[model samples]
Target: MTPKEYFKQAYRLDKRIDSQVVKLGELRALAGCAQTISYEEKIGSPNRNTEAPFVKVLEKVYLLENHINEQIDKFVDLKYQMADAIETLPNVDLGLVLDYRYLQGMTWEKIAEVMNADVRTIYRWHTKALQLVQMPENPIII
Candidate 1:
């Protein structure tokens, strides 16, 4: 893949990880909602039936949480690999540019702000960084 594509993949994975975190939060909230108990239920009523549904919801939440955690791990690992690749570049400015753009998911403007350089300079460095990026022969797994 091209350097731009590799960086885009990192950005995409960052977004997916963020969305999964939100989903995990929502699932936890749902699990909390499922735990509510109504004390005013009539005697001998079907209130006991709530346990089964609540248990099922909790189970689903547990599974989803695990899945999200695994996905986060994989994405984080890929980001680390990307960072390693960026470090291989000889130019410090190019490494910084690629790191900010890919690993940190920063915009060109933001990267310029952080680097204390002009946006045009940042763009130029980005082009050079792409040229310097060395992709691994085998893509990182996970």
Candidate 2:
């Protein structure tokens, strides 16, 4: 794959991780809601097999949390590999542009603002950075 496509994979992994994190949060919230019951509330309610479903939900939440952590670790490793590739470029401007745009997940406008350069210059730097990036033989998997 080309450098642009390779870097885009990182962005996509980040998005996936973000989505999973949201799901994990929702699951944890569900688990929390399942666990809370005052003594009066419990006394009023009938004795039913509530533990089975709550246990299942808690188990699912745990599995999902582990999966999200694994995905995040993969994303971090991929970002590091991309950073190493970006470091190979001789132009510091190009490296900075790539770091902000890909590793830091910054918008082009934001990068321009931070670098004190025009948006056009940021785009130019991005293009140069893509041309200069060199990946290893086995490219990182998204």
| Predicted model with the maximum TM-score | 2
The C-alpha local distance difference test score for the whole of candidate 1 amounts to 0.80
- Using lDDT as the measure, the top candidate is 2
Q: What lDDT does each candidate get?
A: 0.80, 0.85
Q: lDDT by residue for model 2 over 1-142, one digit each (tens)? A: 8888888888899889889888888888887774556566444457666565578878998899889889888888888888888889999999999999888889989999999999999999899878877876777776
Tens digits of per-residue lDDT for model 1 on 78-120? 8878888888999999999988888877888899999999999
* Structure candidate 1, residue pairs in collision: none
Candidate 1 wrong stretches, greater than 4 Å: 34-51
TM-score of each: 0.80, 0.83
Clashing residue pairs found in predicted model 2: none
